[model samples]
Target: MKILKNIILISLFLTVSSCQKWLTVEPEDRSTEDQLFSSVNGFYIALNGIYTDFTNPYSYGAAWTMTTLEILAQRYNVNQEHTSYTLANYGFQEETAKRTMESIWNKAYFQIASANNILEQIEKRREIFTSPVDYALIKGEALALRAMIHFDLVRLFGPMPAQGGDNAAIPYYIENNRKTAPILSLNQVLSKAITDLENAIELLKEDPIISKGPLYSDSQLGGDYQRRYRTLRLNYFATLGLLARVQLYAGNKPSAFQHAATVITQASTWFPFIKTENIMGSSKNPDRIFSTEILFSLQAPQRQQTYLAYFAPDLDGKNILAPLSSRLDQSFENNQNDFRYTPLWASGEASGKNYRVFSKYNNIEDSRLNYNNRIPLIRLSEMYYIAAESAENPNEGLTFLNTIRNARGLVSLSELAPEQWKSEIEKEYIKEFYGEGQLFFFFKRIGKATIPDGKSVNNINMTPSKYIVPLPESETRHRN
Candidate 1:
């Protein structure tokens, strides 16, 4: 395996006043009406900073916590038997995980503060961005990002109390230097998220063009391809795709279905799925629905170390004959044509343990770092899945599900009823998006009954509440 590593060392802290720049203005270092937003370069810097914030390990906190949370949650479900992560071994409630959860909560709010600051500055000097189209585009992107961070905070930490939620989620800070607020109920938190997304969708509609410059090229068409790059930019469709996902999670099915359908209809005009052949080996494939098949991936220039801790026993290179062996064996039972089994499974006499390597995330070659593979924040496939699940008609939902499965070379199940079909659809999700962090949401949304981990059959107990993770002790401390 070729491990590609590129280090794009970025300053972690955003001390807005630290840099000396050509543009300087007013009372709070806020730009003037005739200043920053008037020029294209200023807009670029602001947008770049937002992108940087999203990818920062500390700033947004999605990369580390989201991925880890997904792995733990999925394993909790599939390998409930102590044979894998036994109750004796299950320690997500441990002090270490608690601290990590705290960091994630803090990091999310920090990035939101940055996004809010940008929006505030732009609004303060609205005249500089004379064209309403340009103004709305920038504002919309910021709102979308803000909404995303808020939704994550609610999902990971618990509901927010800002808009009157009683569950008391993490504090909602809409203003810069704002004090933390009391927790809100999940419903209230989601309501605010829905509002933000609606506003964002409207704003982004005013501007359709999105690109900084050329990322790569097979041949030079004009002056500098690098300076004319458009392929790497995130446009309106990408933003809407995320909106659909967040809305769906919040239980706004109609809104979710609408946005998702819009994305599906415009997909070819915006982005297409990578051809199966291209996806296998071609690293430069751009058929991904979004700029990177990643709405907000961690922009690590080079991966120095494998994130093996999140890997299943089947995938981890360090663990020999670990607990994941049996799980993989059982997971693939009777499945012959599943492509995931090959790249993600291992079984042979050459090694004592039947280990499977998840090549999906295995970026061994260093050159791949030039393109960030942090963790996909959102993808077109997810939008498609959301559309399927949110479809008002059960039959239509089945069609959407089959379309995606066919693309991945999986069999289509059409005989099942709506209720039965839902369960099967979720199972497909577990198999397809395994390590992609969609598993937990699936369980939560579907309210799947949890099975126990043990040797005795009588020990099994089903509980839906378990799917909603308990708020970390640290988060609770900040609540009251």
Candidate 2:
């Protein structure tokens, strides 16, 4: 593995003005590793830092969520003059696209290395944690973070499991040291990720979210406030949701169904569907992203900035990320009643032309709202999709699929032929995860030969060459 030297020194501290929050971190401090890991507060700061890093524009904040991957998924209309035009056309080898991919690669591994550092130090400083729950929460989240990053790496750079999982893919970093890690096959990397998640699930058994639910909050444990906002952290259930995602990606249908069903049956109350009042009734501050259903997300304070940068209606055609109005209408099946459609997308004029702009991440007037800054990574509706895809029978699968549809103000889908089940599920993925960036992976996983074109009425032909993103040249040159 090509390690960035600065990431190896993973010392971070928080600049909290009060005890009510612990989300902010000051990374410029150069505190010694020993001094930083001397207490449990230090561990909390380090873990929180990893979560904060995820919000950077190069990662989930923009590139992974609304820009690069979204472009690759054909979710927007990018003209030839736009900077992301090459990405929209799958030009991975272009200079600008190469830099984008390289930044994503390097940022992912940097966080992985930071997580590994915490995993290493926690054991050495175990005595500092007076409460076992504190130890488990920190260590478990670190493992989950590492696994999540590696799994995304595999999804991006590795072949689909059904296609060529035995082929060598990416390196799975497990240690904090500088020794080059060996590149492993896709299946091997997935196995390692599964192992990490299994361990995380076990360690997170003490997670209070199990008993008190995801919204549970209490006083600080060991002088740091890590217990609040369990849903925002990896917590117990989010880890399960991620495992279900990974299992489905690895083609373990039975295992995926089991894990996904567990979340649906047990945690449904914790993450209920958004009430109609929260969406249609509250026009001033609608919950467009359905924050209540978010199993895990990043607390990105800069989310409004992200909205203005890409989806704002005032941006010129080449600068904005809005889709063709007709294309977006087709994705949602032209259902005006669908909560994900009308409330989340609105008509606006940009460059003297009107378009339906994505407002899922738009700023809310009330900062105190729970959904304001959250960028969902895993959601309850996704579990239903996974279960529906992996279920043994079409009837059972349709039931799983229709639950989310009903919640989104659509009627339940009737039983369909087994051959038609995949198509139905694909439609839900397109509508449910519009800007969240799972559509490309969905197409890649199924090896779909063509997808709806974002710019026109035709379908864009696809192949493995277009599906698999090449590893950055920086890493390849190092390997050579």
Candidate 3:
């Protein structure tokens, strides 16, 4: 029965199928409007649906936003033949690259649109929210999501004016619009995002409970209903994490530090880091800190399968992907002691051929079953990095860096002068968070070295102008 449920649920979710009649919203159809936000309970359902959209690969889920954009930046595996990105890496301008970059912008706004709907519905019933906890949780999550979307936009495109005229920020679309909106300057967009996140933090100060009451909980209630609620979900910590990240990106370093510090100080109980031993499958493997480290996580029923394609070796295909020789050559050359290469990759010559592959995401339940791991959107590792970066001194940053490195069984550095220690911080960040989507932005934010791949310039120099991406074509549609 569970297998049947999994099959039905995955079929419905993993594809870009047409919307079901029940899920469609028509402008004139206020039929279910009352039920949509009638109670706090209804608002929770709407919010859950918004989060659900984020997990789709075409959206912010792992396979797309997290993976593709992260290839040039360390923290992801890349095949040599990805010419689309190869073009970007080598400084080639291509339409497909533009589309790929714009895809993240489009999808983030789509999620924001869904969130806007929830916020609009909730505002109509603002009078009913009796406790601060109820009032804050709904509004807080919406604000956080809005800020997150806008922050992504600003990071991609530069600032827009705060005003609403031809110069106003990226349409500050509190109200959803089906039509194209004008672009805002990078400054204006980030300003609004910061405001929204700040407001969310205030509301969530009561630390609202996430498991029950108005929100849907993962009831072991068997069947599609259970699958629907379990994999993609968000709670308070996720909201706070988004706020911290946005503040950091916006150059409000103090604010960024404080917000991150607040989460560390207050939410520690909820989202503790997995001990180092636990990361590599020692002790009972917690589900990638979904309950806590991930204040909110993007979900996909096929996450396990997708992860293996990149992280795991293709043992079935005679080890075609992630060849062992290459892994060893890169990670274990010149007497380097990185165990991730030695223990993680396997190399063998079978049938007169040398094959290499990864084993990180390989454990399958059955011969024909799908892997069901949820991707971690926010983790303690990230928070620790954030905390370290936000610190004013090298020593302070190194403490956090060493915490992560030592946990992974790597040697920790100590007793270095500030000038020398600065490079140490960079080294730890690149090595520790590799493939976790921190490279490009970190390079931009900190003004790091630029490594030219081909024609595309992948942050070979950290120029301030390069900090934000250009506006999407849709955003500039009304400009001219």
Candidate 4:
């Protein structure tokens, strides 16, 4: 509750004027919430503000996607002097680690508060919306966003579900007030998140993505561009995908498998695998992030800046986030032909040393490419991974795993022992989600005891202290 002092203010300054740039809103004073929510356009702009906040460097734009979480997963070879070295080494109490953790915590809660505020206003001003569809879309997305943010908070700061679902996790703020919400157990938090997603799914049943597909665009949907790009927002499919992820994290394999299978069976066409020409043939401007397959993503205008700061070829060795070449090779099983390997990892010269840097998010010259300036939050491939893990049997799981392997340009596996299924899936995750920040959660979800070291060939031993991020001092200090 005390963290609300530093969190509740939502900046609604931007003006939304065009269909092409509905995400862009005009900036106004923080006290304009009443004015901002007076019209339908205000609600759109307010929701847009929450999406914009996700693009902040302190959150998904950088830390969650390409930097802090990746470092924690040992995806980078950070030196002792590097800014993220302490984070990679699990020094959660160190100053740099503390600041990073606190920033992520505060920023995530800020957006949750923003979404809560929108949810409150939308109910009171439902009459302002001319079309019933608009009301559903706006309210569905607000609920989905709140659920998604809270789920991520639980993943980061809560205990691993396999080990301690009864353990107290983060507070679940449902109201837009300074009064503190009760801190819930890990299972309780996951349950709350699932409840929100289930409600969102019902409300989003009429989501355009369900009927017209994710690419469905119309300039005349009440003259609101928010309906144009459903994929960028939390569309129906993305909500299902997040639910699958949360269910799996909570150790509910049957529910996880069911939801994941739903996304794959019904929504695969909306989010297909990237064409081979996009990555293998086009060297100048490859679709490295596989944008075509992203179920949900954020439009990060400063994605190029993120590339330069961490993964650029010119960054000093001490500062860059490149893994050892041998380690990178081992991650992909030395498979040069793998779509996710050669296209995304490239040799670069930095400080007179050659490094195999992560180029999945590197900026390209062609502005016409849709892949540019986008950071994927969820992809179709992840659904496949989840289905494989939670399938009814190992053979059924192997079939699901092969689906991803073939898409990634690898031959299908014939038969595998039951014990080998998990290791194979782990390998697929390492190859599929590099620089995307899912790898760390994958490791934590399984409660792995050792992980491949980014700096050396050895494995880094893991423990609960390393897997669980401490609650930021800012939040803990204010707790009753």
Candidate 5:
């Protein structure tokens, strides 16, 4: 095994110096700072490389971002045939589960180290950048990426926000070094992450993509817009959107509400909700991660087979990873008109017979939508929910809730009593982010138990302690 200390010391800056090939991770170099920050395009290449990490199967690409979180949320059926039996059964102690957890943990810190190296080198060779805007853009994104990775690490391994401010959490590694910084409390990590994002927002305001409309190729630095797919990268607005999520997770309800509301209003032009007309009877891949509903996403290439390996009925006779039909039925609550219902979950009987397979991560070959198996991390509807949940007045909160309901083709209901708002929000959360892996965080945020199982009623309340996955054995075995 590579020394954990050594792994934390180097950068991921590799070979293959093509800007178009930014998404690919073919590194000929050992990822030294001088080699990566050699010129203007080098910074661009390094920044784009971070997004590539999101597609790694060990990290956000599959395990931590989608499948594992879905399993933890009890969003799927639990059976021997399902791949998530260990996770759903709360098998954190098992060797396989620990290895999975360790891979995610290790991969996250590796990227964090890269981000740190990039930021340091950007400052060291400040004159190398032809302009200030490029410097700021690269640095801002690096800061946000570091904070984002650390934030997820904390949520996965740290205590819930409701557990109070003083609980020990994940270590925040800012420097590209072998020395591990001491772990801070949950409150500290949240504060540090917010600070980083705030700095990022200031620099990203000058994001050329925002003004250029789309990418264009040219000789000058500012003229090139080939990689301006802002949605895929954490652009300025997406950074703001992420701030809303971080704020909510930190238990700052008012701040979360305000940030989310801003994104809903300002980012609407870029991420308008999918129109009902385009969604129905379309062979295109607009409904999934590649859809307009996405605020931030990951470009996961060659993932179609991964989807087929688990969800495709004909390919795998012993398919392991699906939900109970009863659980899915109740999740939709028997609303056939709901737009989110039909596209995301269809009968397993379509290919085989029995459980409901996840269709959200399906890779689509739509040249029209530019769909290519992207993985969405944040969506527009989440803002509405954040605003709704954090709103003070019952009518105010209900208005936000109704907006999404109406969009999904469900009839809008009148304002419910104030006490019912939480459950109302819960219902939307279930439907809005089913396979997207958000339910666990929702539960952790609100101390929600009695989660949806095979049956809606008479199910055991999920134990509170299970919400926090244990520190990986690699950390425990090696830590001072």
Candidate 6:
């Protein structure tokens, strides 16, 4: 992992404002390491810098969170032979498509390496953190960040848990140095990721970010305002929420149900569901569900550029990423009243044609933060889906599922049977997380070979080796 470690550290160091310049830094120099992680303040700067990596052009902030992965899920519409359209059809042979998929592998590992450095330093220089609470919070966040990145990488690069149970998968790099780690089984990868999250939960239970109850708005906060922004950071509930997701991905159904239930019951205190009027409001000042429901969201400084490039409905045919009018109709089960289907969509004219755009992310800026734009990575609604899908009791599952449906202004089902679950859950995931880049994982986890595309039902088969994104050519050039 020598080459991989240097790439993450060098890339991260270069982006830090306090680092002065990217050109003057050496990746493995102990002096650089000591200067960056020597104190609590230094650690804060270093940690914030890692998060900037999370929002870079190729990672969560843009392509992975909003553009490329959504295309992979067969979500967007394609008319002419554009790149994103072909990518929706799994055009791995295309140079840019292949590079985009490869970037998911590379950028994810780079962030993982950044987290590993923090985790390692947390142990070696324990005395530097004089405040025990701060120490624990920092340690917890590093562990959670490491676990979250690895979990996604596994899903992107390997087959689902049931299919790849015993198959060899990606390496779990817990250290930043050039260690000779071999590929582990899929089961092993899930286990390592879950263990880190469980540990993070332990440390974050008393996190100062949410320790005083719900975090304050920017105007109400004092003394290190960064600590007040729990939604943007990996705080207590977000860690628990991730634990539920990781457990579900690993097929620990009962554990997944329990963790999801816990988060929904507790996290509601902070991330309460938006008011009914908010969803029914005017489109000019839309109240986005993501801004309120998110457990963790990556701040997207390049949000406007991302939207205009791929999602804006008024864009020319070559740049538009809208879904077909027919596919949008099917995804919502033809129910126009559902908040996700109607208010969250807009019809805009371009080149004498109308297109259907998902306006779930219509507005990225938070009212409280003048400049911050967050792309939701996880939200409370997903927990309800997890609880519903994983519950052993059929009635309990129906209740969980109905809660979300009802919340979205749809009628609740009087009864639901276990046999009808897979399809229903599929629809809910589609409706709940549109434009949030979760549909790909949802599709992969269910081991679906063929999925519905824009009005092209079940034409995209995703089960071949091609769906499993290849490792970056540079890394597989035999560096490991």
Per-residue lDDT for 183 in model 3?
Answer: 54
- Local distance difference test values of all predictions, in order: 0.53, 0.85, 0.51, 0.85, 0.73, 0.73
For model 4, give the 10-residue run with minimal summed lDDT: 11-20
Higher-lDDT candidate of 1 and 6: 6
Over 1-480, each residue of candidate 1 has an lDDT whose tens digit, in order, gives 011111122243332221112112222354542454556446645555556655444432234333444444543232433223422233446665455555666556656766676676677677776667667766777787777778866765563222234565555555654455556677777777777777887886654333321233424334332122222223466678877877776677899999999877765444554455544444443222223334334443322234443333433333221224445545554464555455444343343434453434444343333243444556667777888888888888888888777766677867557568676666566666644556656655555556323222222343433443456565565555
lDDT of 2 by residue, 1-480 (tens): 555433344333333223327665444556667867888887887788788888889989888888888898999988687768999888989898899999999999999988998999999899899999999999999999999999999889888666878998899989888878888999999999999999999999999788767643444244435777788799889999999999998889999999999999889988889998999888789898898898898877778889998888888878899888889888888898888998888778544667788888997777767788779899999999999999998778888998999999999877787778888899999999988889999998898999987777788999887888998887888788
Residue 385's lDDT within candidate 1 is: 82
For each candidate in turn, the TM-score is 0.74, 0.95, 0.72, 0.95, 0.90, 0.90
Total backbone clashes of candidate 2, pairs 3 or more residues apart or in separate chains? 1
Model 3 agreement with the true structure over 228-260: per-residue lDDT tens digits: 332133445566667778767666667777767
Candidate 3 residue runs with Cα over 4 Å from true position: 1-35, 63-66, 74-80, 86-92, 127-132, 159-171, 177-182, 208-234, 281-295, 308-312, 315-372, 452-469
Candidate 4 residues 130-160, lDDT tens each?
Answer: 8898899889999999999999888889998
Location of the lowest summed lDDT over 10 successive residues in candidate 1: 1-10
Per-residue lDDT of model 6, residues 353-380, tens digit only: 5656766655533333421355788888
Cα distance off (Å), candidate 3, residue 322: 5.4
CA-only RMSD, every prediction: 8.1, 2.3, 8.1, 2.4, 3.6, 4.2
